[model samples]
Target: MDKFFKLKENNTNMRTEIIAGITTFLTMAYIIAVNPDILSIAGMPKGALVTATCLTAGLTTIFMGLYANLPFGLASGMGLNAFFTFGVVIGLGVSWQTALTAVFIEGIIFIILSLTNVREAVVNTIPLNLKYAVTVGIGLFISFIGFVNSGVVIKNESTMVSMGNFTSPTVIIAAFGLFTMVVFYKRNIKGALLWGIAVSTIAAWIYAIIDPQGAAYYKIFLPEGVFKYESISSIAFKLDFSIFNDPSKIWTLVVVVFTFLFVDFFDTVGTLVGVASKANMIDKEGKVPGAGKALLVDAIGTTVGALLGVSTVTTYVESSAGVAEGGRTGLTSLVTGGLFLLAMFFAPLFVAIPGSATAPALIMVGFFMMENITKIDFSDFSEGIPAFLTIILMPLTYSIGDGLTIGVLSYVIIGLLVGVYDKGKKKVSNVMICLAFIFIIKLIVSGIG
Candidate 1:
């Protein structure tokens, strides 16, 4: 009996590493569903485009985890999607192809920044308080996503997206998912996200069967193939030579490229630090292992996504959900990546899981993000104001960049206002100053528009 027990314990220990990997991957798998829906509205075949989008995210996330050794996951970034879909494609009247072109260029710039370690320098320059604000702001932003996904908040012409109907499918499923997750959390059940996803996924599937024609439903996995990826046949992945062929106003491309790069820059850093905290992936120095490599892979992933005719690829903050599940190692990430790759075979199944089912996960993740609020220094108006702007603007405004801008500029301005300009955390660096100034100018331009 003793020998048998020893053998069983050894087997369990051996598999623990694998379990860790799977937990990591599962942490970010929600993106496999959400990214596609957000991206594939260009009148393309919804099924095919969603599959491709998932494939890209999965591959990028796996690469980040398995090869890069980062605990982050990749997906169609939220704000960048807004940039691609609304701002660039719709507002600027540019083609999605052009937007992809911009994503490609921006990725290349990121690689350059990573190589020169310019990104590291940029990260190091920020004061600790601002960093805390950004992290907390991101947390709030994440919670906002959760609330919206859960269908808790909704749009109103006058108030703009207040609480939604309690009986809504999104709300009900989200509520159920959140409940299940909370139960697991309270019980200290490991792999809570997996359980939450499983329960929600099953609920989603049952809903589909019952409704048959309803707008909300569930998904069941299956295998299919012959994936249709157009806009991928050509374009050998480089600067569009065609734009060069007609050297007229090619400089506009430069602006587009920079905008994409800027978004990726802040987004990746923010996600890394934020998710790391939730996952407990941070080290004594508050750094994660292979973060730099993860950033490099993520940049490469964005470049690849653009080439494959997708939007800006980025590290998802959603991985925090997995962290809540006790996903501790790269093994967890690899498992998630494998699942993503496997999801390609069963495309329709993923689509079937409604927003309501996953909505709870978002809320739960956001619940976790609020944990950082207590860390902010409330005594100093300089610290308090910037932190406050970050936390408030992130969710209310629904834009990470906007929150960051408000926070940074507020820090600079409020410091000046409070006569702490000299003593308060070194005056905003030149780059931050420039970014803030440009953002102000752009706000003016947007207002004029």
Candidate 2:
């Protein structure tokens, strides 16, 4: 195992990797329920989506471990899934089957890019400061997600968002969990985040038992099931390619594919770099080893996921929890993949782990990701302004692509204005400038549409 994973070189043992895998799985397992619930809005059968999510996550995560030899987990992404249901199927009035076809085509594009070194070129061209910003930005994004999920923050009529009722039991338990995680992390405990989640979950379960109505109010409690076996026949291999036959729909298909490509491209890049930075896996050149393979597997996962009736499958940001837990090799990914495969039979049990429990781990991981801020050359306004924008816009816009796109544009424009290039070495790269213009055009087109 050491020889295979180079565990010693990575400074991790089998036991550490296994524990890290479990920790990562626990942090992200909510996707089993969440993906189905969201995608069902597009008229998909929830049961089939559950099965598809598990299969795609399991198979592709294992492939990532074995092929890329990286400890990242793959699943249906949160943002892309919402776009699939709400933006495409409902807003565009396209059929769910047609949406899947578009996703499949996007995956094919991704595969071509990965194999031809196009993806690698984009990764290598990103400036170092922006790279760090991506890490910190994703961290803040994760924390914001945790806060919203745990009801620590909520929408308000007066302000766009405001503090939630802290007295609520759900909020209270999540706060306690965050406190526990912080304390344990300070003490340098190995599985502090995991322990915090367990304790918080137990508290929630006890509260639910004591006050079933209150628990019902929050829609959180011990789910009553040991097993959940959902049939996949409804969506398995049910992709409809007939949308290509309609010439009138070609323009809509083009726009749909472009949207999928744009979001998936940046999301995968940001996530791979962010999670890798957490593990200190990127080299001095700011490149990840086996990036092409990792990206290929991700593309394959998306294609298969769409075929199996789910949205774009990509690397989850939650993998940072495993890195924080001392995972340094592919074994960690293997363990996570195995659990996802097993989750096919235990869906109900996995879904029972409430948001309040996982929120703490995400909060702590966000704390860890903030460490990258120190690496940014804050003295240089050219770098600092864009970095600052990246950090805020990620959570503020609730979109990684938006954060990255705007950050790139801001960096390039500011670099030009200051007459100082990245690292004072050269002018902003043409690729980034072109991408920024494309993003602006995309925004305009979206508004018009």
Candidate 3:
């Protein structure tokens, strides 16, 4: 195991990797319940989706470990799934089968891009400052997710977002967890994140026992049962290619495919760069090692996830929890993937680890990722402005892809101006110029549609 994963070389051991994997799984296990619930609203079976979600995540993550040798987890993406259901199915009045077909087609295009090195070239083209900004942006994005999940932050009528009631049990519990994590982390405790999650979950269960009504009101409760398994027979292999039959629907299909492609492409790229940056896996050239294989695995995960009845499967940002926990190799991914497989039978138990419990870890990881902000060359406005936009817009816009889009567009525009004005001040690559044009076209098309 050490030889294969190069444990000593990476300065990580099996125990640390194991804990990191468990931490990563705990942080993201919400998807097992959330995905099925969201997709079921689109008229799919919830039970079948639970099984498919686990199966796809487990297999894909394991493949990532073995093939890419990167400590990242792949699962059906949260935003992409919402888009599949709400944007495509409900808004466009398209059938669920057609949405899945679009995802599958998008996956095929991604696979081709990966194989042809188009995706790698794009990754290589991103400037180092922007890459650091992406890491910092993702840190804030995930931290915002933690705050919202723990009920520490609430939607406000007048202010847009406000603090939740301190009296709320969820808020109190998450605070306790955060406090615990801070103490342990200060002492250089190993598995501080895992410990925080465990402590908070225990506290929640105790609260549920003491005041069941309040617990239920706050959506905090013990597991209903153990050892439950759902079959994927109903939803697997369910893609419908009927959109190709009608000439009128073909245009809609094209639009749908493009949307999926654009979002997944950038989301994956941003995640890979951000998480890799945090892990110190990027080389001197600002290139992530084994990125090609990682992209291929992600593409394959999406294709297989579509066949197994889910949205686009991509590398998860929550994997940063593992990376922050000192996970440095594929071993972490293997352990994480193993837990996902185990979650199939123990779904209720795993799902019972409330979002509040994991919220602290994400918030802490966000703090860790913020260190990258210091690395950005903020003295240069040409670089500083774009980097600032990238960092601030991620959490504000609540979309990594959108933040990256605006950042890249601004970078290209600013660089072009600098080059023209100062003659030798800045040089924007042709790839970046083309990308800015593409982003403009995407925005225009989306608006027109």
Candidate 4:
């Protein structure tokens, strides 16, 4: 009986670790299911894109574990995906092949920046509140995307279809998923996220059975080129490089890559710093042991993913939810990586699992991000405004970089107004902040122009 009990405890620990990794991976899994819609807006075929998304993400997660040696997971970056698929492809009217080229060239630039330590120098310059704004903004952006995609926030010419139908399959499924996870969370179940996925999966299958358009939706979902329902099938195998003929496009590639690196640098840094604190991953020197290496790994992951025809790959803040569940070490990352690898092979299964099922997880993460708002020192308007900008604009602006720009600019402006400039020259942070502030001003001016 004693030996059996010991074995059980060991299994429980292992389970907790596994749960953590899976939860972290899941934070971005929805993208695997949905990125194709964005990527294919420029005529990217379905199968190839889905495969590329999964394969690249799975490979990058492994790299994060083995190379970075941190319990971090990687996938198609949240903000960059939309930007790559929307801002560049649709808004800028760039071809799909050109977009891939942009990602690839940018990945190479990132590699150079990280190895030369230039990226770190730039990153260390960003302020804490500005950083917080980036992470929280990502959370809000993520929830926004989820809500919008689930058909909850449809944009009508007059007004957006911005709420639930209550009777819609996606709506009902998401609600059920949210309710199930909330109950599980309140009940203090270990791996509530995992349970939520499971419950949601069953619910989706049940919904499909009862869906009025069951056959049609299922067929549309089972289209030829999907890895999961949302991403392209051959995302890793489909980088068509024919769009580099134009000199203007080539130069534009340079601009895109740098911009991606800048945004991703702050996004990954802020998320890791914030979530690591919550997960107790930080050590005495205000660092996690393999944190820098983990970042380097993330950069590499993005490089490889870009090459593989997917968007940027970066460490997810959602992984911290697993830390809350007691995840620790490379073991957790390895487990999550394994789950991702396995899930790719079973794309249909993952696709069949509705995202509404994960809505609860998102709502839960929102609650966590909101907690950071309390840590802001509200006594001084300077500190208070910047912090408030971080918390509110993150969700409101729906872009991490957008919110970060506002947060840092506000901090500097407010500080100058209140005479709280912490003068320094040796520090890289001040330099980055100064540069960032200038760039943000340029962006604002350009927007006005």
lDDT of each: 0.65, 0.88, 0.93, 0.65
Q: Give the distance in Å from residue 419's predicted Cα in candidate 3 to where it truly belongs.
A: 0.5
Candidates' RMSD to native: 5.3, 1.8, 1.0, 5.2
Which residue runs of candidate 1 sit more than 4 Å off their true CA positions?
1-40, 43-48, 90-95, 215-240, 280-290, 416-449
Candidate 2, clashing residue pairs?
A: none
Model 4: per-residue Cα lDDT over 128-244, one tens digit each:
554454445555655665575454666666653456566666666666766777788899988887777667657766666666376246222322233433354445445655656
Candidate 3 lands at a TM-score of 0.98
- Give the number of the best model, judged by lDDT: 3
lDDT-sorted candidate list, best first: 3, 2, 1, 4
If both were scored by TM-score, which would come out higher, candidate 1 or candidate 2? 2
Question: Candidate 3: where is the Cα deviation over 4 Å?
Answer: none
**lDDT at position 16, candidate 2:** 88
404 Cα displacement, candidate 3 (Å): 0.7
- Top candidate when judged by TM-score against the true structure: 3
lDDT of 1 by residue, 70-109 (tens): 4466777876876677777677665666667778888888
Better of 1 and 3 by TM-score: 3
Model 2 lowest lDDT segment of ten: 417-426
lDDT of 2 at 444: 91
